[model samples]
Target: MWDDWARTAQPLKGKVAIVTGAGRGCGRAIAQGLAAAGASVCCAARSKSEIAETVALIEEEGGVAMAFAADVTDLQSVTAMTHATIAAYSGLDLMVLSHGVALAVGPVETTDPVDWQRTIDVNLIGSYYCIRTAVAPMKARGAGKIIVVGSGQGHNGTASTSAYAASKAGTWALTRSVAAELIGYNISVNELLPGNVRTQLYEDTFGQVISATPAGGEPISSKRSHEWLKAPEDIVPLALFMACQPDIGPTAQSFSLMRRV
Candidate 1:
């Protein structure tokens, strides 16, 4: 089954993609997956070294990719990245907004105002910037796909995660709004929930939560942590599925890999 799926998932042969936050975690994984599926991918991120590593890995696999340093919070930077991708590959078909931060992971009252705004800027507004820039190129192609990497916490807030949750919730709302606007243009906008993948952001945010609990009341243990965590590669199939969908495929929707309680 796996072999068959892999063989058939190569429909993106001549497509082009831009993956934000491609330096590591979900962004890097999806960038690699898209390239393996035959799309020329642009690995965009703030970390020059990290994105370079991602590009190297993709090239080593006989895939086409380029590293672009971009700050999603800056509209000009995002626009430059989009233009560069189009200039390099001729067109853009897919964009995966996987860049985010968890800096304001403490009590709401104590959360730094600047940090909260920065979180909103990177996670929510940054998404808007990418979406805005990709619109023209996608419209030029007459079809496109935009995938927003979101979280379950956006649906129901968790304590000490107010800023992060708020930003994601805004992203979810933004996804739907954009999807509706692009319906006639054949542009599919959607959200993808990657669940509890063990990335650095996860370690810093959740680790802080676990350590703050009272003695004998730990919400997560070392052993349980492993069980709950998942590898970034696990998201590849679902992402490929969404990216490979038809022009008239589902939009203003969310595809989740998270388990229910």
Candidate 2:
């Protein structure tokens, strides 16, 4: 059944997909993957230069993509991005909220207030804006896929990551609420909780912790762990599957992609 689904499930072909934070990291990978799967992707981010690079890479590989510069934290920018995508593609079929920030090494009480607010604004509020802005076009079409890029920390508590962990947890809960509200419209809303992905974000945040901690003290071991720490490419197939598969059936569910060591 799964093979048959995969074979016949190029439903995303010629469909429009919007991927935020597509400048780099997992977001860029997801955007590229969607485009490769035959979706016309809107690659959005704060940096035009980085988004342009992503678009160039996609076009070089013969995939369709367009770069839109927008800060996900800004509602005006989010609205502009949605409008631009609609103008370019007529309508949106998929919205992937892949952009997020984290300050993982700080203790809750000692964490910088600026970082805390930024994390909440970027991870929680930003996702809401994307979903909220995309809903009208999706409702008009009466169908769409919304994928929230969540984190394993949302499922389980991780020390020294109070703000990031809280924001992701909120994202998961928000996804559930949106899923309930949109199911009648045939919009499948889901969350993907990635574990220890080797993205720039992961490297910047956890890499320091990994480097400082002793071999045995490492949260995710450095040795015999490379195979388990998912690559950005590893995540793309699942995202594509969730977005393209018909009859996703349930709403308000979350899936984890971590391999236990």
- Estimate TM-scores for all models: 0.93, 0.89
lDDT of 1 by residue, 55-77 (tens): 99999988899999999999999
lDDT of each: 0.89, 0.83
Clashes of 2: 0
Taking the tens digit of each residue's C-alpha lDDT, what string does model 2 give over 11-79? Answer: 578789999989998899889888877788999999899999999998997778899999888899999
Tell me, by lDDT, which candidate is best. 1
lDDT of 2: 0.83
* Model 2 lDDT-worst window of ten: 1-10
Model 2 / residue 76 / CA error / Å: 0.6
RMSD of each: 2.7, 3.5
